[model samples]
Target: MLKTYSVSLAVGILAGLIYAVLDVNSPAPPIIALVGLLGMQIGEHLIPLVKRLINRQPVNLHWFRHDYHHKIGDNPPPSGDKTS
Candidate 1:
């Protein structure tokens, strides 16, 4: 998770730095607009996918955690085993 956010931040900063050299009339706007639209369209589903990959979690990208947020309600307390 940390690595994913770090890479994302680094890429965003690098992209911003590169684009800062360009004028407003540049074609960067359309590409950025498309990326932003795609991000907004699929960001929530994407981040958890990235996090699962980063953590080596044994779950698919479109699993219940990311695609379905609340299908399972609050879990009941465990038995008196007192496990962590």
Candidate 2:
């Protein structure tokens, strides 16, 4: 997560620098677009959890944690799983 945010910040800074060098007005639409995209992503993940909460069902967090670990390469591959 930190890495993702750091990369985004770096890209934003680079984009701002480019705009400054080009003497072009920075567009507001792209700023809002990224925010909207982030909101959609958050909603996509959270909506299911919210629905489960409303129905008094247990939220299975195993997959979520598994995926996070997988992304960070912190989880080991399955034992004896031969991948040629």
Candidate 3:
């Protein structure tokens, strides 16, 4: 998780530098950009959640907890499991 965050911050900083060099305005304000990122994170989970529903698979609190951990690479499910 730390590595993922570190890489993301690095890329963001690089992009900011490029934008500065090009004198280009950011497409959205910081808050808006953050909200968009949040939406993206939710969207990422939504697709799989819907797929599970469509497949007539169970969707419960346990699944949500497992999926959350899997996505964050924290306490990931066992290798034999298909949840990830």
Best-to-worst ranking by TM-score: 3, 2, 1
Instruction: Tell me how many clashing residue pairs each candidate has.
Output: 0, 0, 0
Error of 1 at 23 (Å): 2.5
lDDT by residue (1-84, candidate 1, tens digit) is: 999999989977765676667534334668786885587558756776688779997674335544344433544433453223
- lDDT (Cα atoms) of all candidates against the true structure: 0.61, 0.65, 0.76
TM-score, prediction 1: 0.32
lDDT of 3: 0.76
Q: Deviation in angstroms for 54 in model 3? A: 0.6
The reply for model 2, stretches above 4 Å from the true place, is: 1-28, 63-84
Cα lDDT of model 3 by residue, 11-66, tens digit: 78876786678676776568866876897688877898899999998998668767
Selected candidate, larger TM-score, 1 vs 2: 2
**Candidates arranged by lDDT, highest first:** 3, 2, 1
- Between candidates 1 and 2, which one is better according to lDDT? 2
TM-score of 2: 0.37
Instruction: Provide the lDDT at 43 for model 1.
Output: 70
